[model samples]
Target: YLYNGAAYLESTFAAFKQRLVPVNVNYRYTDAELVYLLDNSDAEVLVVDTAFVANVARILAELPNVKLIIEVDELGEGPNPAGATIAGLVHYGAAIAAAAPAPHIERSLEDLWFLYTGGTTGMPKGVMWPHRSLIGSGGPTFKPFGFAVPQSIDEFAALALTVHDGAHDPIRLLPAAPLMHGTSAIASWGVLNSAGSVVLLTSRSFDAAELLSTVQRRAVTNLTIVGDAFAKPMIAELEAAEERGEPYDLSSLRLVVSSGVMWSQQTKEALLARADVACADLLGSSEGVGFANSVAKRNRLAPTARFRLGPDAQVFNDAGERVVPGSGERGVLAVGGPIPIGYYKDSAKSAETFRTFEGRVWSVPGDFATVEADGTITLLGRGSVCINTAGEKVFAEEVEETLKRHPDVHDANVVGVPDEKWGNAVVAVIGLEPGVGATEGTEAELRTHCRATLAGYKIPKRIIFVDSVLRGPNGKADYRWAAAVASDDR
Candidate 1:
């Protein structure tokens, strides 16, 4: 299992450099989950951090295909480390120092890059990204920095050199999101491809203070985060710092990119007020370039959930017709650019996600959205999480975003539970801001707050305030957990 660190990057590049497949293992997984993922991915070699050695040690016997194990010590060289208990484990740094120089091996455009989905609702599936498809998909990501898509290795090398020619400083990027997810890993690859420095947070869990301090210290030019899960805390920290009259210096940051979940416009505007950075909220999934993106600056601000569709992006209704602009009809958003090959072994899912819609193969990750008259799209939640209550359809994200707009709400996840009258009643699991108590009038206050933006039916029927709303490491909502909590509530 890899954590977000230099060693993780090193192992990833080393695997690619040696033409070996590198599978990312979520450190937060249970022993069974870990075993299933490693075995399913056909992972032969394991590169794990010492911090997670105990979990690996327990599940090591189950993985027979894993012949070699390499242990990376997060702590600097010390005697009797945690990984020392694991049998037949090679030290990461020592192995590199003793190994012979790598032999020249010609790489192919067809070489596969395995990116496992977040698996919020199901088991994580590996998405196969060929070098050709992956590189082609990154054109827009690098274009903003004046870096062109290099056609050949020679051209790529030339571009890398140009970034470090003293006339132009190489871009320093810090992906606040974990590298295990595609959101951060792909962005880091783009930065490294252009000879830019990829800065990582040493802390395992996210700390907004550390992120700001690192950006100021390293002169980071670009940043990547998930959604409000990361942004909210960062905003709080920035405000706290300013209140103390020692605001963080964020002049070097030019772009703040987010993906995986809905990034509220309120958070984007807050960040822009604090620093002169453009927030690019990407509408995409692990399956695919993207469906759409909303870029917010000081003046050029787009509304929450509104995005301009990509060149090949479209929404298709159940009747297989393109959704008409200004029709107010909801449909699945599809992107038909340089997409993935397919899921590694599941042909059924592969066919379902990467489908032939209107004679064109588009990666449809089942995101529900509506087309506006001006050719922009307003995103609803994912189809998998849409709730049905009394014959009325309510997207979890749409309601969740509305609830989060309240001042006291730190985070919110909406789920549907069994209701006698409604069949499925909308229930909200909310996390309040620091020191904010959930009073008897809290539910009424939130309901009143949501009524301004949300319809009566769309408003959450029952508000459950927890210490904090749970989410995956990638900032994807834990709907399953919320559903369970709601279902258990009388």
Candidate 2:
């Protein structure tokens, strides 16, 4: 599967320019998952890379509403590796070159943008983002840059044109996460809307060297990554390069933005020590943005998973009461200002996720967190993965963060395993740093490390050391995979 390169960007821009809704498809989806998304989105046309043509061909019969298939030939001129072909499949370039020019048409702010997001346990859900909503949700993107929020189309265009006229500096961003994910796609769209440049990696997978070299060569001003999943590897590359006596030139990078997962303070400090870049750890989701963010520099660093809540953000208990700061009570995080319209074609989930809080509509994405005395909130992972061991609640993120603090551990994931004594035992699956091996007493050593920061009940009862902890392409934790491993080994 190709990364979100020129072809993907071209399709997105073309569709948006012509007032057509663009739905992003995950390249890692199976044939069944692909069919479900296409069918659920009510898609009329499909654009796919030649590398994935075989899978699309297999699922074609299930999608009757798909009127056209535009093939992007990523695999040079030879026959497709899978020899998969569908009748009436149009070439991407040919379709573009032979198309007649489109007539000017008035576009509305109500036009929808479908962003499909697959959470931990369900089929992908299309989050409906209208153009008007994008203005509000996207406001945060401009805020950090000291740009004024435009009130009208004329004002927006006038500001965007300044980059071309040399009146304003241009933003060149590289989204390290797959563009199919909201964290990357939203950043990409926001950059384009500001008349900035978006640099995509040619490599199909995440390559730290490629990313660093591109940053140096393209003079990337901003970068978007998904938490420690990306930060750790990039940091490893930087260290490796330094040890080789040839460090990368990261002076051009002004800012580094991460969201959708936990970006540890150690990793942030590691990057800040090497590069003069500000790291913005965002706490939000596809349903909403601007919930909270923590900006860190070398001199000024924030604690891990600690964020200053946005003006419109609030945490509410199950009883629908506003959570008190320093109360030590967990609640669902919600944001009221400038939220999505809702999920497409799923009224039940839409109603559940986006609800009326007091008088304003707020997005509650089921994240659990506690407010600290300092007025900052500490995220405690999602409620879905929270483990209740012998009536004591243990957040996987809290345990995982403590475990990763150990020098030998590169990554860690905590999951609840079936236990006869505790009902559910808190089990950890850890991946060590490169060249680090697990001995017979490695589990005990890791457990001792966890005891320093975690409560007795919260400390993992069982630790399963694996070669590496697996995460999704978007850098989100794969709790399901961890659970399976814990179950099988038990």
Q: Write the per-residue lDDT of candidate 2 for residues 1-490, one digit (tens) a residue.
A: 3457788888887888799999989898888889899999999988888878788788888888989888887546543555345778888888989999888888888888898888877899999988777766777666654676666878778868777898878889999998888888888888887888899887778899999999999999999998889999999899999999999999999999999877889999999998998999998798888889999998899888789898889989988888899999988899988778899999999999998879889999888888888889988877777888999888888888888878899889999998999999999999999899999998889889888877899988888888888988888888889999999998
- For residues 1-490, write the lDDT of model 1, one tens digit per residue: 8788889898888888888887878777878788888999999889888777767777888989888888887666342365556678888889989999889999888888898875557788999988777787778756854767777999788877777676467878999988898888888887787778999888878899999999999999999998889998999899999999999999999999999777888899999997898899998788886778889999898787779998779999988789999999999899987888899999999998898887888898888989989999888878788899999989998998888878798899999898999999999999999999999999999999989988899998899988988898888888888988887776
lDDT values for all models: 0.86, 0.86
- Report the C-alpha displacement of residue 83, candidate 2, in angstroms: 6.7
Distance from true location, Cα of 314 in model 2, Å: 1.3
**Residue 286 error, candidate 2, Å:** 1.5
